[model samples]
Target: MLYYKQLKVLFLLIILKSCFFAICVAKIGFSTKTPYEFIHPPQKNVIEDDWYNAHTDQYTCGAVHVSAVIRHGARNPGESDSKRIANIHMRIKDNIKDGDKFKLLKDWTNQFPVNNNKNLNDAGENEQHHLGQRTARRLKSLFLEEDMSAVQFMVSSAKRTEDSALAFYEGINEEIPSEAPEEFDSEVNDENLRFHTMCQKYINSVENNSTALKEYKVFGSSDLINQVLEKVIAKLGVEKNVLEPADLKTMFVICGSEMAVFKFSPWCDLFDDEDNEIMQYWSDLKKYYKNGPAYRITWEQSCPLVAELFTIMDDVIAVIERTEEDKDTEGYLLGNMMFGHAETLGPLYAALGLFNDTVPLTSKNYHEQKNRLFRTSEILPFSANIMFVLYECEENEELLNDEEEEDDNPDDDYRIQLFVNEQPMLIPGCKNLLCPYTDVREWYSDISDDCHFEYLCDPHKKMHNEL
Candidate 1:
């Protein structure tokens, strides 16, 4: 009887081991597949009707400054498993009020598969590339025939952002010199320094909290808590980690010379205002940490949690219209490159007021052009707008000449026009010329259900003739 009992126990252990291995393999295999579905339709060509006779009507002989903001192009979807993991965790936490039960299940289930794809794929890359090219081409067509090398260029630090900038610049193919200096390598080094400083700050806070440290031990997993504790202890032991603080500091300076400086100014207020709400949810998640640090949730578990809150924060930020004061301040650039999953785009667009709003396009709208031209392809289920902003100095009346001088070329005039859905509309001019059209109404007499519009010489006349 004793021998048979021992055999049964061995058999049970083997079964458990096999099950654990299978789960691990399944999770690993599931994560490799694309998380989001890619949807591609037929590409449309730029219609000839989109080009209006701006030279005859609204062409201003003076220089004008323009700015634009646009959405990034389409991108690949997120990991399927991570989404699954987040959904399961959130669902369990929401439905099961019992703390002990939650912890018990969470600890056991945390190893399961969750969301999946983590970066942009081929379609996303192409979207950004094409969008940038189209935007650049359109800008060149509106501006003078001179090389665009003199234009000041700023881009976000994301992969897609950088790619978009490169593609756009290539498309323009003008010999214009870059207004900004090239410092890609140095800028990357500075970002690394900034990240290290943030990490040090977090470590310092952890060391100062004796009660929290104890709680961290009880609630947090041994693996993560111990790793953090080890790093803190090592920092206290030796000054070796202290590099040439001066040299390091110099390397880390966020300067204008850097190709990518992520200034959180415009969006900082949005994030700051929601700190309380974010912390509240974070605090709630702490209750489950009886087995691990709340903030230390794995990427798989954190993606959904972060995504949902981020979406809400985006909505809150979108309502904040830029004040006159904001307009006066120097602008913020999103970055030249963006990596990670595509879901990051939704909240970004929501914050920028790109969708679900009925703000009619007008002359004043062009003033906010810089914000309107920002674009990316990392976010799925959305199309990106390729907008451009051209800035020029105020005109000197003394330079004005009534007759076309022998040297003046009529084909090389400076005018800002927009091509929307194959319909051309002139943007509001500066102090030099009177804007002939007020809204889209003057261009398209018959209001069609389709968002597309066509140019009309005189809408009132067209209606009168029809009558």
Candidate 2:
């Protein structure tokens, strides 16, 4: 009787422990739905009569060149099966009994590698197609169908980038030519063509005199540098005899490398000082490249591009300046604008001067913009309109007309204006939090009267709404 009682007590204890464990797990995993919860709500409409009226005069003002640095459509960050394999491996390592068996399982799992595949998964493919269609439609509305063919194309070599570009061309029924012309060759190889070009330009700027190297202390010795220069020239495919100037206008360059390389590049190094700077940059870059660090290389590399993109505004201003000065050049230029991305658009936004300001958006906000931009898992998705304007500044005149003004008194500045999705918005004040979704949310809430949410709750009302 004593033995039986002891056995019953043990069984009861085990049962109670199991029940407690189950409860704990349930608590950890379970979540309650709130009344105001929304999965992915519809974004607010940005186009209004005010926005249309502002640009109405420019419709027939001739050709304009638009260069968009777009984030690629929706995609699984890494290989699709990575998570499943990781979960299984983690479980086996944690729960398996034998040390040898665990080692064997780990090796087997690790042996199956993950990489970007050209033939994207179902979600990626869909994103590509949808984005392509949307891009085509937008182009049709913005420019004559015939004009799209003339616009130069440059896309990153990543599978998604190519996929996005292809889908875009297909949607417009633009012929996918076998190859772009040699003059427009923007494909960057591993040999560092851009760096080499910059080096050559730097050398030429100094009149090829080695003594001039004293000015830029960062550059190494110039005596043997000529030999290095020869190698750089050969590697970059630059003919030493050719005297043509570097073509910086009307050319598109698409650079794609593992995020790791971008972090370690000289450009990133410039931002950080010596001592721990190089190591810190490498560590940060590697973290993003190895693990999923959300938007990494795209943002870091975009800073310089943003600085350069400002030149566009400067060009627009120059046209305005020319108008002010009564110069002979055409006052305006217009063309179809297209950009491709593989993931988050945070980098694109960062490169566009938005990230440099105070109070930038966060990664969470960026993710929200992703859902809003794609609206589906389809590849090659199109984002809302991004409008840039250059207004002529009088010697002492206010930058904006009273109705088109922005808060923070942006109108009082030099008058370079940027609009996302046709809304006059402020750039986030900080680099760390420049997430686009937060901006979208704020914009949506601000203009809620103009945007109806009936489509979010009712399946029947969820029809495609386009700009």
Q: Evaluated with lDDT, which candidate comes out highest?
A: 2
Query: What CA RMSD would you report for each candidate?
Result: 23.6, 22.4
TM-score of each: 0.29, 0.36
Clashes of each: 64, 30
lDDT tens per residue, model 2, 365-387 = 32233222222111112232343
Worst-scoring 10-residue span by lDDT in model 1: 26-35
Q: lDDT score of model 1?
A: 0.28
Tens-digit lDDT track of model 1 for 1-467: 23323444553453365457434221100011111111222335533212222233324232232232223333333345334434543443454444453343333232212232323334344544554444443343333343343333443344444444454344334322345534332122111111212232222333233543443234233343334334322432323333222211111111100101111111111111122122222222222121112222111122222232223223222322232236554322211222222223332233222221233212223223222221121122222331212211223434557753333332233333332211232332323222322222232222212212112211222211100
